[model samples]
Target: MTEDFYCDEVLSDKIQVRKVLETDNVLAYYHTKPFWPVHVVAIPKKHIPSLITLEESDNELLLELLRVIKKVATMVTEENGACRVITNLGDYQDSKHLHWHIVSGEPLKQLFNERLQ
Candidate 1:
């Protein structure tokens, strides 16, 4: 995978995702590969690397991203009664792109299998 999966694959449309919400600057979608029973991902339309990498100039973008996250979280909570919004950085981050996960429910055992082919 590339350093910025969101920019390289997701935003590029190389990887198709089920969209939950979308706006001029943000997008919320069902995870391409879900880890939890109810997992949704939200990302900025523009590349921002990671949360810590955000600059003061990105204040508006950050606010927009948060709005999308909040909306997605609310929907998840309404359906599941509970939900969490999370973001990863540094080593914990598999994708270097700035993205947030609004998820609910327990983790799944086997979401997708590896194909030897």
Candidate 2:
């Protein structure tokens, strides 16, 4: 995988994604490869490497991203009764892009096991 799949693939149109929500600066979409039964990814349209890399100027963007996440999470939770909002950092971050996952239901154990290896 490339260092920034969001930029190199999704944003660039190299890979197509089913969008859940989209604004000028934020995008929420179904994960290309989902780990949970209901997994949606929200990201800033601009390239921000990761959460830790966000600058003061990015505060508005961050809020917009969170708003989209909240909407997606709410939709999932209303249907599933519960959901999780997750983000990975440092070594846990596989894509190196600032993204939040809104998911519900038990994770797919097979996907977790495969990623561990």
* lDDT values, one for every candidate: 0.90, 0.92
lDDT of 2 by residue, 33-111 (tens): 8889999999999999899999999999998998898889889989999999999999999889899999887789866
Worst 10 residues of 2 by lDDT: 105-114
Candidate 1, 34: how far from true, in Å?
A: 0.3
Q: Return the TM-score for each candidate structure.
A: 0.90, 0.91
- Report RMSD (Å) for each prediction in the order shown: 4.2, 3.4
Candidate 2 regions exceeding 4 Å error are 110-117
Residue 2 local lDDT, model 2:
79
lDDT tens string, model 1, 1-117?
678888899899998899999999999999988899999999999998899999999999999999989888988999999998999999999888899999897767544343322
